[model samples]
Target: MGKLSNCLSMIQILMARPKVKIDDLAAELGVKPRMIRVYRDELEKAGIYIESVRGVNGGYSLDRRSILPIRNFNSTEVQELQIAIKSYLSKQPDHDSTLDNALEKIKAAQRDQALSSKHFYFANDYLINAEVGNESEHYKRLYHAFNHRKKVMITYEAASTNAVTKRTIHPYAFVVYDENIYCVAYCEQKEALRTFKIIRIHDVVLVDQSFYLPENFDIRKQFPHLGFIREPQEVELIIDTPFSNQVKESIYSTDQIIEELPDNAIRFKATLNGEQSIKKWILGMGTKARVIAPEHLKKEIQLEVEQMLQNFQK
Candidate 1:
């Protein structure tokens, strides 16, 4: 890449991340650590101030405001760009607040050129911009643990029960589902892998302990439903018409099997994690959906209905 393009790329990287090491820049730019020093000097000359830290955990960063150059995109590139932006924003580090501005800029570009606006941004319905801190310091620390494969201690508030607890975890991966961010980690207390919503996480601190991830620890293979559970359980549901008939085809998990029943309903079966999530989905559907097998889930739903009815009567 040309020097000017390289400099801009470096600036963008620094802006997106809290800090980056010279080694990282070198690898990305196909250069040497010494070349990073030269680029830093060049950036300084261009009125871009990059703060450098020296030590074992040292790197460079900048907080100055800089406008990204806009480019015209072809039809295919526009679609790809929208997808790229949505993907990035959906899984951005918790400390990343500039994503909103970046998305706004993309929207502006689309509006200026009269491009289609639909699907340019993640649908708000699917995502909760549920940030725990305004400055996102927790996200930053969590990222540190993830990047270095370190153990981290965290205080987490449960989304279902609102119960709060503390645990130490070996940070593994960050998964994005329906535009929401979740951290998948091995919880020391649970002795298993669990997914924690980013919004429910707080007080994340590196435990000064390192960990080696398992050899087959692929995030996608390990987490099909955003890391909610490490294991998948068989789930069978009966969808009543006209919702069942309205569903044109299988749209949920790729492994889901949908069969048209003789009674004009649909039978849906899939191995999934997160019983609570499925329960909530079923409850949301009201009378339109019912659990078939797994008698325990049916009873759980029955009790939930009873409780709701009792509450309404009160």
Candidate 2:
């Protein structure tokens, strides 16, 4: 196995077992006992504190206190970590080079210093697939700005007003919300921290201005709503067997309650964000799903369907 795969495997083995002998680890990694010692040094540099017992029952054990929150991640969650890192690097034009450089550094930093959450994640297979497009060049520029605590000037096109405006912002961080990449920055125009979708930024340039991320600043704390777009609204959808899994796995899958209905149907209820988003999803399901509540949303869907039928007939 490659170095990184071996590192992750070593972590998994140590996490699962109480103690493992050096010979055992050497055999598991298909390397000499000398190389096992080298792996031990690498893991130690990464802040994985392995304690060696020098006795007849000698073996290696992880220091519980030295474990970062990554120790809490299972194999599935490890995959999520890969996606998160990939998305960050993909936003840069020189992604391949950036990813290689980042991985080398990641092998050394636990990232516990950068983390705000005591428990960094929850069990959800939902993967991040953000689209960066040609804006990746600017994204690359602004990405460094956030990293270095530098301010940036951006010509932004507002999604709500469709107005283009220029603003100087102190960038806190870049985050992916609802598969859309956003720069959570302190906007000088509004004098407030706001979420700006990276795609809507028409132009961006780094300013010579430097700033600090507020001691209390946290992206999750700023925007913790389950619904990814607009505001959340209550809705219930009754779906047949064929459509059940799709609704549960949807992008707006927030605060969901699923109950089995008679004759192989599922009742799925959720307080989801984005009225238009949910309408489009239900429409896509067609005969497989039906709305059970919210008369206004049902009426909106009916009108939307009517407009679609008119377009089809023309």
Candidate 3:
């Protein structure tokens, strides 16, 4: 394996099983114990804290508080991180040689501090297939506008009718759920908050106008209850066993209530803003879940499933 790869593997191993002896590391790396010391020194130079305990119970372990969070990444996450880093680097202009040089140094430091075998155990299978076109450009512009608290003028193609219309919006933030990116913005034309899919934006232009974010505007708090476009609404769902745990853990955080039923089923209740997102989530669970309360929502989900079945038959 390459030096950088080896280093990353070593770091992962140490993080997973701290207090591992030098001899064991050498055995795992297929090198002499002396060489393990060299790798340890390299890690220390790169700002990793490798505490060595001596005597009969002597071994090396990471000082958990001092070690960076990257040490905990699974192999897939590491590969994704590498791709993101490369993508960012590739976007830098050709004239930015100094920045490129600095990036190389940073990469080297990261490689030296990481566990070498971490990259060897598994093949990276997660591929991020982001569509690169006008939609991608719109996403970038929207992200910038949201970050800078600026308004944006966009030509959006409505999903329901596919009609194109121009509108001005105060871009608030973005939510990347499932495989799509959504922009949460205050639409001046609609006089209400709206969520626009980045894919449906035909054109986007950052406007000079800026807007003030409300003091009560907490993205996480509002997102779960009201979603990007919808007003907050109370919704209850009945989930069957095995799937109940998955549903509860995935959808509701610690704040939400989860009640266990005698039938080994689980009931989840939450005040969500956008029913659409949660509805889609329940449908994804298949027959394992059913919406009990709010007669309208239950009917909506049933209708959606029937429509899906019809589309499939075609």
Candidate 4:
């Protein structure tokens, strides 16, 4: 039998007997231990649970629940599966409907309950510009670095002055905000966690050097104040009447403290980083937003508006 056929047969055998030794299986199938590992990965992708056990008598097992028999698929179930797969594929830049059709046929043939249960759904409201140029390549490299726990060298563009410089970093995760992709990595140069915009990356090179992630490290918990902008700063504002509610929901801030006023107005406070991002956001709100604290920010906004008016008048 071919490798694919052999792998399928191995899954069937493992399903019949939940607990089976890797060595015993390899001997029985006349395949090497390396091939067994490969087949195990393929089985996992197919939604089968193959877990390794440790100790003297420990081996591999098709997790009890995952060994359940395939469920019959009705027309509705098949259509739902097809729709779910197509929806997921649509999110990718290069995927097409044909792949979705093929997956649907495969699901129909297998009638796998796990596949049926593993449906895809997503919701997106903002418009994202398709990334271009070396940026895409940089993103791919960073993604691989994160997946493989490897270090990388990246030429990055700073948002403040658009200055480009090279730095070595340990990629932790990729974050998407304001329709832009960012690499949240541990910067070796800075000795701190920093977020790099993919669009700003001029080039990337993966290095063989690898590092282990700290056990207590949780990206989401560490960057609670992060939004579209990755910088760290705090700002409080008291928005005048008629604009407070809109500002409360639309503005991206860490902690939004809203206080109702006597004259139908509201006060909002939020911690923000990335002054440029906040400035742009304030400009987007036009007159609806008012800067309560930090006199410099208000002045900056005034100057920007004046410049904008000058352009329009000309």
Q: Specify the highest-TM-score model's number.
A: 2
RMSD of 2: 9.3
Candidate 3: tens digits of C-alpha lDDT, residues 117-172: 21111111111124522236676687667657799999999988999999999876
Ranking by lDDT: 2, 1, 3, 4
- In the range 176-281, model 4's lDDT, one tens digit per residue, is 4444556777899999888788888888998999977665655555445434435455666666655555544443444667888767667777776556656765
**Model 1 bad stretches (over 4 Å):** 1-171, 176-182, 185-200, 205-217, 222-232, 245-251, 262-264
**Most lDDT-accurate candidate:** 2
Q: Return the lDDT, model 1, position 96.
A: 30
Better of 1 and 3 by lDDT: 1
Error (Å) of candidate 4 at residue 4 is: 17
Shift in Å, residue 223, candidate 1: 4.6
- The collision pairs in model 4 are 233-272, 233-273
> Candidate 1: deviation at residue 275, Å?
1.0
Q: How high a TM-score does candidate 2 get?
A: 0.61
Q: After superposition, how far is residue 285 of candidate 4 from its true place, in Å?
A: 0.9
Residue 36 CA error for candidate 1 (Å)?
28
